[model samples]
Target chain A: MKKHNYSAGPCILPQEVFEKSAQAILDFNNSGLSILEISHRSKDFVAVMDEARALVLELLNLEGKGYEVLFLGGGASLEFLMVPYNLMKVNGKAAYLDTGTWASGAIKEAKHFGETVVVASSKPENYNHIPKGYTIPSDADYFHCTSNNTIFGTQMKSFPETNIPLVCDMSSDIFSRVLDFSKFDLIYAGAQKNMGPAGATLVVVKTEILGKTGRTIPSMLDYQQHVSKESMYNTPPVFPVYASLLTLQWLKKLGGIAAIEKINDAKANLLYSEIDRNPLFKGTVAKEDRSNMNVTFLLNDEAHQEKFDSMWKAAGISGLAGHRSVGGYRASMYNALPLESVQVLVDVMQELEKNS
Target chain B: MKKHNYSAGPCILPQEVFEKSAQAILDFNNSGLSILEISHRSKDFVAVMDEARALVLELLNLEGKGYEVLFLGGGASLEFLMVPYNLMKVNGKAAYLDTGTWASGAIKEAKHFGETVVVASSKPENYNHIPKGYTIPSDADYFHCTSNNTIFGTQMKSFPETNIPLVCDMSSDIFSRVLDFSKFDLIYAGAQKNMGPAGATLVVVKTEILGKTGRTIPSMLDYQQHVSKESMYNTPPVFPVYASLLTLQWLKKLGGIAAIEKINDAKANLLYSEIDRNPLFKGTVAKEDRSNMNVTFLLNDEAHQEKFDSMWKAAGISGLAGHRSVGGYRASMYNALPLESVQVLVDVMQELEKNS
Candidate 1:
């Protein structure tokens, strides 16, 4: 049976990524060495690192724009700390738009550095919608926001214009849509969703924004140190970086984010339409702020829960269970998740409605 | 041709680990989903994380010793910063043994927290030997050292007895030999050399020694947070952790460290003896302080370097070049490296001597 994996990050990557990465583990480029056993500094792996960094810039259309791409270890959770350490200065203020869990986490870390001002938050409404019309402090060191909230199924439809440096945690939505990426001074995403596997985080930063903070930053957390070393600041998570390159290559071959955005839109529309149209189901997030990558919906009648789950399981849908915080089903349709898989999920949802 | 990989960390792993991990990537446990695509919270991966953590304790004989094993990302370099963040108090001091580059790196990070005392150092001699007879400060929050120096090919034969929390970075030597693992309160190793791959790090720390630091640690760098959450504090580097588990399983199947240590000793002895006896080459470090994992040697005559390099390449020996700082030849015979591979290199050395 073909499994439609909608696993939330560490989520579905392309099938070709699976095949090629598996083959690389067996024999990397016919070098007779497992990719797992090769040195990060070797010519072969260096080529991989270089190509991956270059490809990330090329795909984002940020090449020749003072952007440096780094495939670093530790997830976006670490970035929450690094962002503050690298950008936030002693006695300086940072403005943050708290959209969901991750954004709040970043805000929490930023507070440790200095004064962190939450411009606005949708936490009162249980983060069902992206906070809008948030004021940005002109004197703040930087403005930070989460582009998409996987747990709440909310995404920022439009970013706030600000004079301060823009930093966004696009962990769940990066490479899944087309955006004027150059607007953000710094962007980071864990390579689990719409990228690669779980071990590495993708950081794209404009070089001009770093090193202005007066405080001394630790080497691992310093963006300037990582950029200077070309992301090999320490032995990077080699496998994750390689797998991400494979995924980015797969994405490029499928016509970059512009093409994938259309497909993603179609997938999100199909499932959301079924939820909205069907009498037994309804969407959890606000309509306007709904995430195209992760679709959250609830059964109108709680009595049909068991039956709906069984139907989806029978249809080979995996990772449909919503996060514990949110009680409902979450279909994470990342870049690698095909439109047909979303159709399968929609059909299951429709079948449940008919049975109910 | 069979390649004998002697690349220092991210070097060689067991053949079975390669095959099994590759298979898992394609179809994990016959679940019809690549391990790369599965959720870290899924039962299958959870079981892997649990087993890997347990095996680390069991192999090190640290189970029931109040030691918690955490498989984290960001490598040992990240752990360098994390150690101080979690262990060093705001006004407290730390005692360190400056063995080599990594040790100095750790000391540099520790200085940012509070007073860091380098009790002794072998760096003046190019890190050719581990500093001995160092008196750890009784008032220090913790005593730190590197168990093995990969770059300089040196290993600590004995640890200083200290009442203070003992921390060691065993990035290149963990799991290769049997030791009184409880002697150290915290042990961290980047999983690339004797362990698994380059993405994950193994941190074994005694639970009782934590939370004493007065400084508020960031959530990502907090040991208590990771332990409380069972090392899934955030989505861990799944693939590296999983591969590390497979390598650990292979080690256990081969009768754990005691069994592998004998083989490791044999491989080291065979190669080191040749470096000492052969007229064409000489060992780098002091005889008593030589590392079993990495054997560094230099040619007696630099003019024969070209001929010797070609000979080894032809013999299918790869990654034998020493680190740039210690430019010569280094045969990194980790646990997974068969004794026969060492023999092949020794044979090449004999050939070089005859030709000379």
Candidate 2:
């Protein structure tokens, strides 16, 4: 069987992204220096920065808006604190939706800066679904949510339509589908998922919402400082930025988000359908709130777990085992995951069913 | 002519490091997925981290000591703040030897946490030397210094024996010499310099000297947090760490720090001797302070600047240009800079002198 990667992150990349990236590493822009050596301030690299930032706005189709695209050093975990630090005024309370591990991590970081109101939480059920029916406070600095819960395989399919700024930790599923970006003030993603490697976090923020926080933030942690310096305040993770750029180019070539969204939906549908139709498999997240990015499931009988694992490993499908924090199986279907890989996985489920 | 790279960083790597890294990126340990795709938490990658950490101690001959090696996300700039956060607890005073832009940046970052005393500063003379004779405050928690100044091309040939903890930013000149590391309580280097790439920081800290700071620090910004977790409180930068591991293996194969230090000494001596002997060029820093890592010089005649630049460019030497803030020529002679490249540059200088 062909090798497939389902490793939640530092996960997967389109084969083309890898090919083009490897070529550039040896010799970037045909310059004598490898892409590895070129200065971020050099014209070739500056053009890369421009194109990357432009593509981010373009991909979201927010070309006319005042959103500043920032590629920063620390990953989304940094943004977990940064979002509140940048948006929360002195003693300001922010409303947070506690969906899973990452969302709670973000809430923990936010509490360091100001009061955090956990408007809704799914902890009682171990975060099987995005919490609903909790009123969002307009007076709170912003309403924070995790667009997709990577660990628990839950997604906030419908965001609350409120005037309050909707801030999201969209680390795992940012570029996987078309986002109604106008509905949110800030959206940040760690590049490891759907974008590139782990060094850079891509932040899309409205310029108007910044500079209101009263905290004296460190330059590295401050979003406004990055904006004023145009993300050139310091040496960036150059290769990852270039890889993200290449992946975006791949996305653009593959007909942008709308086209890719259909393909992703089809891939997720195939696997979810297989789980629904099969007697031995059952998804962990509630059916309505299941994530297309991370499709998690469990065996009907625990005795078959080892058998399924061995068969899948032998067939060359990797990263299919679920996070130990939430065990069973999780096949992360990020944008780079090919439909064929899912087909292989689906075929394995069918094979197991037939054997049984 | 062979190409030479003197970039401050994402700088030169030995041809061997590049060859090995390029191959690994294309087909990592025959794992089918790129090394970039593997999670840092994976067994394969955990081995990469283990070997890299072990190699650091092995090459430095710093094993079984007070030092603890850490590969972290933020560059040495992050360590600027982190150092004081962990160790600066005595009377709110942290003394700094302001050697250059980077060392001064550290002092600035430290001020946020405690009272920072610039015990000595070389700035008025454009950071041409490490200042001397300013007393280290016995009551100060730690005295910080940059081992080798990257911009102005000066080095502290002998570290100050301090009653207080000695913190050094060894970014540009690490792996270029055999050091009595026992003198340093903390040494940090951004890996873009001598190690591998720009995203990771190699921090060597005395483990016993932490957690005394009464102030609360953001978990991400605290050194104790990283030490306790072994640099995996969250996902670390996997690719850079692995690439650094490969580079360290290459360093070990080149016969570790002792063997490489001999070559480094020869390379620095040859270039500095030519600078002293040549009629067309004049060395900038005082003889006692000139850095072995970066050789800074100016043309004897200001009009010879363009000719000198054209000559180097024609010979394919890149990033030989000094930082704009400090103009003239700065040939950064990191360990990866082959002696032949330096010879070519020396020959070019001689040829220019002959023409003059």
Give Cα distance to truth, residue B301, candidate 2, Å.
1.0
lDDT (0 to 1) per candidate: 0.92, 0.85
Lowest lDDT 10-mer window, candidate 1 chain A?
A: A347-356
Give per-residue lDDT, candidate 2, residue B164: 82
Q: Give me the runs in candidate 1 sitting further than 4 Å from their true place.
A: none
> What lDDT score goes with residue A16 in model 1?
91
Best by TM-score: 1
Q: In angstroms, give how far residue B295 of model 1 lies from its true place.
A: 0.3
- Per-residue lDDT tens digits for candidate 2, residues B1-356, read 23688777778877666666677667788888787787778898888888888888888778999677889876777777778878888457888899899888888788777699888898999998778777888988888888899889999888877788888899988888899887888889988878987778899888877877687666777777777887777788877787788789888998988888898889999999998898778888888998989889888798888887888888888889888878888989887888888898998898888877
lDDT of 2 at A94: 95
Fraction of native contacts under 8 Å reproduced by each candidate: 0.84, 0.41
DockQ leader:
1
Q: lDDT of candidate 2?
A: 0.85
Candidate 2 segments exceeding 4 Å error? none
- Give the chain B TM-score achieved by candidate 2: 0.97
lDDT of 1 by residue, A1-356 (tens): 65998889788888899999999998999998999989999999999999999999999999999999999998999999899888887889899999888899999888788899999999999899987766898999999999999999999888988889999999999998989999999999999998899999999999998998898888889999999998998999999999999999999999999999999999988988888899998898899999998888888889999998889899998999998888899989998888899888888877776666
